[model samples]
Target: MGFIETFGIVFILEAADAMIKAADVELVGYENVASGYISVLVRGDVSACMAAVEAGVRAVENMGAKVYSSIVIPSPHPDLLKITQIYNIDNLLP
Candidate 1:
């Protein structure tokens, strides 16, 4: 999985687009942390995920936007996925 943290909706959209275009990756979802802090999540093979994240960071920087954070998790634990529900949120409903 890969994550990109930005400060605005425009940045998030641009970053996400660049990331996906850079590699074969899927956008899991996004989270709005409030106060203009937003996080985008993506999932794929380790290499692709890494490349996507790097591309996203570059996209934001090239656009003169700030990237608060970027992370690539090669192999997240199944239990962690269960807790985060990154790839699927429908399961979270009771």
Candidate 2:
């Protein structure tokens, strides 16, 4: 699991896009915590997740936006998966 948070929808989108293109990963949807703060999530192997997060941060920085936070969890706990499932986009797809 991995995520990158930034201000504004555009910055988040750019981060997500760069993340997906940088590695083999699945988009886990996003979280909007209000006040224009948003986070984009992704899931993949440790190396891939790390690469994705790095790319995301770089992308946002290149756009002149600051990355609020970022993380790459190589082995997430089962409880964390429960929460992440809520943000999973598979349910939204047909």
Candidate 3:
């Protein structure tokens, strides 16, 4: 799992675009924490998640947007998903 935090929805969308295009990853979702702060999430293999996050940061920087935080979790705990519902598994069910 990877997370990229930045200001504004536009910046977050740009980051998400760069992330998905830079590697084979699935965009879990985003969280708007109010006051223009947003966090984008992605899930994939460790290397891919790293690359995606790097690309996302670069994209935001290139747009003159500050990246509040970024991280790549190689192996996140299953319980974390249950709590956050990052994967939105319920939406994927048939």
How close is every model to the real structure, measured as TM-score?
Answer: 0.87, 0.90, 0.90
Clashing pairs in 2: none
RMSD to true structure for each model, in Å? 3.7, 3.6, 3.2
lDDT tens string, model 3, 1-94?
A: 8999999999999999999999998888899978999999888889999999999999999999899999998877766756567546543211
Please estimate how well model 2 matches the true structure, expressed as its whole-model Cα lDDT.
Answer: 0.87
Cα-lDDT of candidate 1: 0.86
Query: Which candidate number maximizes lDDT?
Result: 3
> Could you give candidate 1's per-residue lDDT for residues 17-76 as a string of tens digits?
999999998887888889989999888888999999999999999999999999997767
Model 2 C-alpha lDDT per residue in residues 1-94, reported as the tens digit of each score: 8989999999999999999999998887898989999999888888999999999999999999999899987877766655766864543221
- After TM-score superposition, the amount by which residue 68's alpha carbon in candidate 1 deviates from its true location, in angstroms, is 0.6
Ranking by lDDT: 3, 2, 1
lDDT of each: 0.86, 0.87, 0.88
- Give every collision pair in model 3: none
1 or 3, which is superior by lDDT? 3
